[model samples]
Target: MSERENEDRKIPASDPVIRLTRYAQVPILAGLSVAMVLFLVTFFVDIYDAIQSFEFLDRKKTILLILNLLDMVFIANLVIMVATNTYNTFRLKALVQGDDYIQQGEKAYRRMKHRIVSTIIIISSIHVLSELLEFSQTTPLQVAALLGFHLVLLATYVVTNVFKSSD
Candidate 1:
């Protein structure tokens, strides 16, 4: 036994991945929580700015262009959802008490990372496709170069997740 457990202390059942997962959970959540609060604050401020622009009903350009508005909603929702998720993931008091909720939260946290990455990739692809459609003379070479880079990035992330995932 190691020095800390030399006296027959016990640890929860864990494999290398689960052990690393539990170990990795806290700092990641903590960092994400800090980010969440900052983004929520920013979102609120942006909303106020947007509202103020409504006061100028006669203006040519309103609060935000359509794409800008959509981007704000997407980012704000991401920040809020991730923030809540990180909190639930890192809050382990229920886990200590053997609560099912904590386990669910942990699972959700893991799943969310995969889901979020996939969502970003899909949305990015759509955005790029739209831009390509708008451009009258985008070259195959330029498009292929851009797409090749994204494909490499996507493959890398997928491989990393597969290697890291237990199931």
Candidate 2:
């Protein structure tokens, strides 16, 4: 190929779009870090409440604490995935092996989505279970709504997996 043709194919070293994309990760990282802190703080608070009141750590309270901790874990996982994936995506080609890095980014995205759906399903199930266990207080309508939400989440997870497998 001619030198000019090769030059045309190359991205400029000072390309604004690439620079901006890379720069954007700074704020994203900062924001997610703050959220991570809050998640951790709240998770600890839930644990403290459960343990400090050990005498009253009945099944309902125990389940709620466990659910809150699980939710926090899922949130933390999501934040980490977003932060790393964002950094990976905007990184300069010179810093990473080209096609392989890009493929890994795609795989990360797929895994993130699967985790998100699974997290929602688990959280939803916890909510439903809590409601069901409170047999005397939970209305039938509330029970139905919670069950429906959980079913939708399950369906979404299944359909997403099927499509991903097909690909």
Candidate 3:
């Protein structure tokens, strides 16, 4: 064997700290997987519901369906980002080139923060749309609160993007 190869194999594969840290992420990955599966199940259920009620379809319902699907997509993206990034971050061997981009310290933190904020933006948008479509059942105070929440999310999204662009 080459000297370099032997040296590479010398890196400890049984370090207790590294093993603990890597396995610590197992629960997180499992949780995200469960959530992702639930989202997929909910997506299918939404499709089934729409099909079952095809004859009763209306404009508002159609819009809500689209928005709901979009929300699910964003949620799936967030779950995937967390699962993949966490694995790439802590695993002995990184998974992909994208993992290199998501390396440790400030860069990783910003990436995660941005992803979470973006997910929140999508969620808040979904809530706003739901409130708007069901306005008849929503009080003025409720509408105001929903709008306020959405605005805050929008502001965060904009600010984050602007600052991130500079970085």
Specify the highest-lDDT model's number.
Answer: 3
List the candidates' TM-scores in order: 0.45, 0.76, 0.74
lDDT values for all models: 0.62, 0.74, 0.78
Residues 58-126 of candidate 2 have per-residue lDDT tens digits of: 877677667657767866876787787676666634465546656776777787677777767776776
The alpha-carbon lDDT assigned to residue 137 of candidate 3 equals: 93
In candidate 1, the residue pairs with backbone N, CA or C atoms under 3 Å apart (3 or more residues apart, or in different chains) clash, namely: none
Q: Residue 7 of model 3: what lDDT?
A: 62
- How many clashing pairs does model 2 include? 0
Ranked candidates, highest TM-score first: 2, 3, 1
lDDT score for candidate 2 against the true structure: 0.74
Q: Which consecutive 10 residues in model 2 have the weakest lDDT in total? A: 92-101
Pairs of residues at least 3 apart in sequence or in different chains that clash in candidate 2: none
Q: Which stretches of candidate 1 lie over 4 Å from their true place?
A: 1-72, 93-106, 136-142, 157-166
Model 1, global lDDT: 0.62
Taking every candidate in turn, the Cα RMSD to the unseen true structure, in Å, is: 8.2, 3.2, 5.1
